[model samples]
Target: MATSAVPSDNLPTYKLVVVGDGGVGKSALTIQFFQKIFVPDYDPTIEDSYLKHTEIDGQWAILDVLDTAGQEEFSAMREQYMRTGDGFLIVFSVTDKASFEHVDRFHQLILRVKDRG
Candidate 1:
């Protein structure tokens, strides 16, 4: 007799998407969160994924973190990421007023795409 392998029910998975304006440190923040190292330079992100297995409040889960591009040039790709994400980290440069403005736009778009109002 042949046996089938099934995924463990105890394993939980999560997708976290990082969104923000260019040069706002989105990649740096995501990297630092799991690696504890600070990146001192700026680089444009096309798309990047980082995986980490973690336990929170005694519950085990795997996090698939998606670091995304911050430029409007990549806006067309944002909705795809937004839809697949279980959660989002919206970011903006504190010292740059324009980035703050973009944050609002990003938030609205996420709400709209996720149909959350």
Candidate 2:
């Protein structure tokens, strides 16, 4: 027996921001998902580089992932992204524990910005 495809309920357009520290697979995931290429040993992203915009299923998106220095120390960079984004992916490497611990405060930052922009 076979079942038909389920239609997606109407959803508004979204602006997404992927946030994480350096060398935590954020760029790898973005390149793989959008560009459809995977370079296991690629170069790093400079502080300022324009990532390509892409469309999927009629929804327009620009994968503007952010890279902030001092992941171990607190910074205001993430709050800046959360201000304009409709959604986010806060990534941390499974192999690293320190990266995981720092995720908490960023969640709070997202909440605070949600009310503004």
Candidate 3:
């Protein structure tokens, strides 16, 4: 019989935060990856969700995924969390190049925040 290639339970947890515009499907990606469920046309309904005990490379992760508002009103709160996360998933739509441009600014902000932290 062929042997299974499952990893051991000694991997470290890593937090992955997705940040981007409203219609870019950050919520959908999160749901798809975490819940293993997918919808053809899902909305950005996740304000914040807890994905407990996620395993990556045999390590467990308690991901506190904070989905910030895509609107301009939540900029402050968004910046606050961006500064605090371990890493990020800054996505942009291929159809909208403008959003792609803004991702750099956000990426720079995260780097700055994490550097200071």
Candidate with top TM-score is: 1
Listed per model in order, the count of residue pairs whose N, CA or C atoms clash below 3 Å is: 0, 0, 1
Best by lDDT: 1
Give the per-residue lDDT of model 3 (tens digit) for 16-109. Answer: 6678876777777777776889866946543675555654544454556665556566667776776667778898888888888889887887
Error of 2 at 69 (Å): 6.5
Structure candidate 3, residue pairs in collision: 11-59
TM-score per model over all chains: 0.87, 0.62, 0.74
- Candidate lDDT (C-alpha), each: 0.88, 0.61, 0.69
Q: Which stretches of model 1 miss by more than 4 angstroms?
A: 1-10
RMSD in order of candidates: 6.7, 6.3, 3.8
Error of 1 at 38 (Å): 0.5
lDDT of 3: 0.69
**Regions more than 4 Å wrong, model 2:** 1-13, 46-74
By lDDT, is 1 or 3 better? 1
Task: Give the candidates in order of lDDT, highest first.
Answer: 1, 3, 2
**lDDT at 69, model 1:** 95
The list of candidate 3 runs beyond 4 A from truth reads: 1-13, 40-46
As for TM-score, the candidate ahead, 2 or 3, is: 3
